[model samples]
Target: MFFASDNSGPVHPRIMEALMEANQGHAMAYGADALMDEVRARIRDIFEAPEAAVYLVATGTAANALALATLAQPWQTVFCSPVAHIHEDECNAPEFYTGGAKLTLVGDTDRISAEALRAAIEAEETRGVHGPQRGPVSLTSVTERGTVYGLDELRAVTAVARDYGLPVHLDGARFANALAALDCSPAEMTWKAGIDAVSFGGTKNGCMGVEAVIFFDPAHAWEFELRRKRGAHLFSKHRYLSAQMAGYLRDGLWLDMARQANANCARLVAGLRAAGMEFLHDPQANMAFPILPLRTHRRLHEAGAAYHLWNGTLDGDDPDQPIAARLVCDWSISSDEIDCFLNLLRA
Candidate 1:
C-alpha cells in the first residue's frame, strides 16, 4: 500500500496518452506551441476569467515563486501561515525569487484567522523605513494539517489583507483536492474570493508533472514571463507540460481524480475511527494526520506499509506511546489497497 505521498502515484493513462500524441511531430519550442494555446484557453474557460494570465511550469515551487515575485517587491514581506508550503517547504525559493523579500508568518497553525492576520500585518512596517513593508498575503487551502478552509474563512483572511491594501496570492498546491472537498467552482474558491494570483496545481492530482500560474489581473503577465524565464523554469520542450495539463482538464478529469482521492481519504478516516485511533485533525481532502500507538506503527512498518511519521520515533521504550503520521491517498490507490491497510492497522 503506497500512501507516502500523492507525488509518488503513477501518471494517469490519459495524460500519458496525450504525451504520446504530443511526441508525434515537431512543435514550436517554449510557450509558442499550439497545445499551450489550447491549454490556456481551456483553463480560462474553466476559471471563468477571460482575461486571466496563464503560464505553465514543471514544479509548484516555480509557479508559486515566479507568481509571487511578480506580485511582491523586494522591500516587502509576504504574510502566510507558519506551515504554508511557501514558507516551510519551498527552501526559501519565495524569498530568493522575490529578491530578498521576507515571509512574516501570520499564525502559529496551518490555518490562519482574520484577526491573527490583521495583528501580524499591523505589527510590520512600523519603524519608519527600518521595518519591512507589507506585500502580499499567501493563503493555502487544504492546509498542511488536512483541514480545508471554508468560504467564510477564506474571505475573512482575504478581507484582512484587503484592509491593508495588499495583494493576495493563493498557494494552491492542492487546489483540485480543496475544490473537490468544498464542492465549489474554481472561480468561487479563488478570484471571486479576492485571490489575485494562484498556483493551480495538476501534478499532485493526476498529471505527469505540471502546474499553472494564473493571474486574474492580466497586467502582471509580462513581468511574470520575464521572472519565469529568468528563474530557469521556462521549459524549452514545453509541449509535454501542455499535454499533461490538457489531458488533466479534458472532460473534467482533474475533478474526477480529486473526487476519487478525497473519497479514498474519507474511507481511510472511517477505518481509523473504527480502530479507535486519535486524529490530529479532521481529514477533509486526501490527507490525514492520525495518532496511533507505537506498536501499531511498528507493526505497520514491518508489514511494508509506506507513510511519513509526523511525531515520535519508532525507537522508543514505550510501545503504547501515541505517534502521529501523515497518510495521503492519490487517485490511483485502490479501495482494496485501503482495506488491506486498515486490516493491517486492526491486526
Candidate 2:
C-alpha cells in the first residue's frame, strides 16, 4: 500500500508509448516541435481560450514561479494562503523568479477567504515606496491540507483580486484532480473565474514530468518565455516534454486519471470514516488527511504501508495520541491496496 505521493506513481503506459514513438524522429528544439503545436492547440481547445498562450516546462515549480514572475513586479508582494504550495512547498522559487517579490500569507488556514484576501491586499501598498506593493493573488486548488476550494470560493477569492486591480494566478499542481472533484470545465475553474494565469500540471496526474503555463490574456506570453529561458528551464530535447503533454491530453486521459485518483481517495476516506477515524481535513480531490493514533501509525508502518505522517512522527511513546497522516492517491493505486491499508490499520 503506497500512498506517499502522486509523484511516486509510474507514468501511464500510454504516456510511455508516446515518448517511445517520439523517440523515433528528430524534432525542433526549444518547443518548436510539431508535438508542441498539438499540445498548444489541445490546451487552448480544452480551456476554450482560442487565443490563450500555452507553454510547457518540466516541473511545476518552473511553471508556477515563472508565471508569477511574469505577472507580478519585483517591488510587489504576492498574496496567498500561509499553506499554499507557492508559499510553503516551492522554497521561495516564486520570490527568486519574481526577483524578490515577497509572499503575504492571507489567512492562517489553507483556504484564503475573500475578506482576508481583501484585507491583505489593502494592508499592502499603504506603506508607500518603503514597503512592498500589492501583487497578483495566488490561489491553490486541492490545497496542501487536502481540502479543495469550491467554485464559488474560487470566484470569491479572485473577485477580491479584481477589486484591487491586481492579477490572479492559480497554483494548480493537482489541476486535474481538483477538476475531477469539482466536475467543472477548465474555463469555468480558471479565466472565467478571474484567474490571469495557471500552472496546469500533468506530472501529479499521470505524465512523466510536464506542466503547462497558460495565460488567458496571452499578453504575458513573451515575458514568460523570456523568464523561462533565463531561468535555464528550457530543455534542448523539448519534444520529449511536448510528447508527454500531448499524450496526457489525448482522448481525455487526464480527466480519466484524475477521476480514478479522486475515487481512490474517496474510497480510502470512506473506509477510514467507517472505522471511526478522525481527520485533519475533509478528504477531497486525491488526498485524504486523516488523524490516526500513534500506535496505529507504527503498526501501519510495520505492515509495509507507505505514507507520510503530517503532524507527528512514528517514534513517539504515546500509543493513543492522535496525529495526522497525509494519504495521497495515485491513479494506478488498486482498490485492493486501499483495502489492504485499511485492514492493516484495523489490525
Q: How much lDDT does each candidate structure score?
A: 0.93, 0.93
Candidate 1 structure, TM-score to reference: 0.99
Please write out the lDDT profile of model 1 over residues 85-132, one tens digit for every residue.
Answer: 998899999999999999999878888899999999989989979989
**Which stretches of candidate 2 lie above 4 Å from their native place?**
none
Please give the lDDT score for candidate 2: 0.93
Give the per-residue lDDT of model 2 (tens digit) for 176-213: 99898899899999998888899999999999999999
Q: Estimate each model's TM-score.
A: 0.99, 0.99
